[model samples]
Every structure is written in structure tokens, then in C-alpha cells.
Target: MSRAGCSACVRAQEQLAQILADYDLRLAVVDVDQLAEQGDPLPRAEFGDRLPVIVLNGVEHGYWEVDEKRLRADLDALR
Candidate 1:
């Protein structure tokens, strides 16, 4: 997730934790301003303007306010 101290990111993290309780998924919080500290070779401009981006299976899911019901159904289908 590309977050920058946004309140929406905090809320989304809480909601996602509840929804992903049974899944073996991991949530990595990537601070857009601190990527360089983590040795990320990519440039921040790629996601600078878009904070709270959710990545699922290495694909961009979307920004904040994820569809909980739809995501649950997708996870169920994955099973």
C-alpha cells in the first residue's frame, strides 16, 4: 500500500484486517516518502499522486474505500 499518513489508510487497514482474518495474506505498508529508506529502486513519481493503493496478487486493486463484499466473494472464489 502506498500511504502518506492519510486517515483513509488507517481506516482501510483496520477494515481489511477484519476481512482478511482467515486468509494467509500479508499487508505491507509502504510509506511513499520513505521508499528510499527501504532500498526501493522504483521512483516515487509512479505512485506519488496516488496514496492508499491496494495491491492484490501483484496487481493494483485500487485506492481507498475497497468494496468489502466484492473482495470477500473474490476470496471465496479463490478457495
Candidate 2:
């Protein structure tokens, strides 16, 4: 999603990355604009400007920010 113009998006990304780091996981940032341009289903067509969306195991857990408590729980489940 659009992390460039949103401060909350940046913060969410940083927090999610930090949390996942403890589990030795790396966060993957997707270039949504490119996907949207290509007419991807979950991009510009559906999501629009809502960004910094957190997709955990292919399911949306949060948007515009990372749900820290839920994220911690989800990541912990893997361990």
C-alpha cells in the first residue's frame, strides 16, 4: 500500500518489522501502485488508498496500522 505519504503507515511498517524480527522473519513490502496499474484484484480496484495493510498468512489482520497485540499473538503461534 501507500507508505510514502502516510506517517502512520511508516510507523506501522516499522513496528511490524520489529516484532517479526524477534522470530527471525523479514517483512515484505509490496509495490501496490504497480499492481494497481496492472489491475490486480486486491490493489487499486479494491483497496484504493487504504494502505500499510497487514496481511497475515493471506488474511487481512489490520489496515492503516499494525495491530500490535494481534500481530504478536500471530507471530508467536509460529514459534
- Which number leads on lDDT? 2
Compose the digit string of candidate 1's lDDT tens values, residues 30-79.
77668756777363666666667766777776776777887778778888
Q: Indicate the residue-level lDDT of 14 in model 2.
A: 86
Q: What is the C-alpha RMSD of each candidate to the true structure, in Å?
A: 2.2, 1.9
Q: By TM-score, how accurate is candidate 2?
A: 0.79
lDDT of 2 by residue, 1-79 (tens): 5545668778877888898898888888765767766777566555556777788887877888677888898888867
lDDT accuracy of residue 19 in candidate 1: 78
Off by over 4 Å in 2: 39-41
Best by TM-score: 2
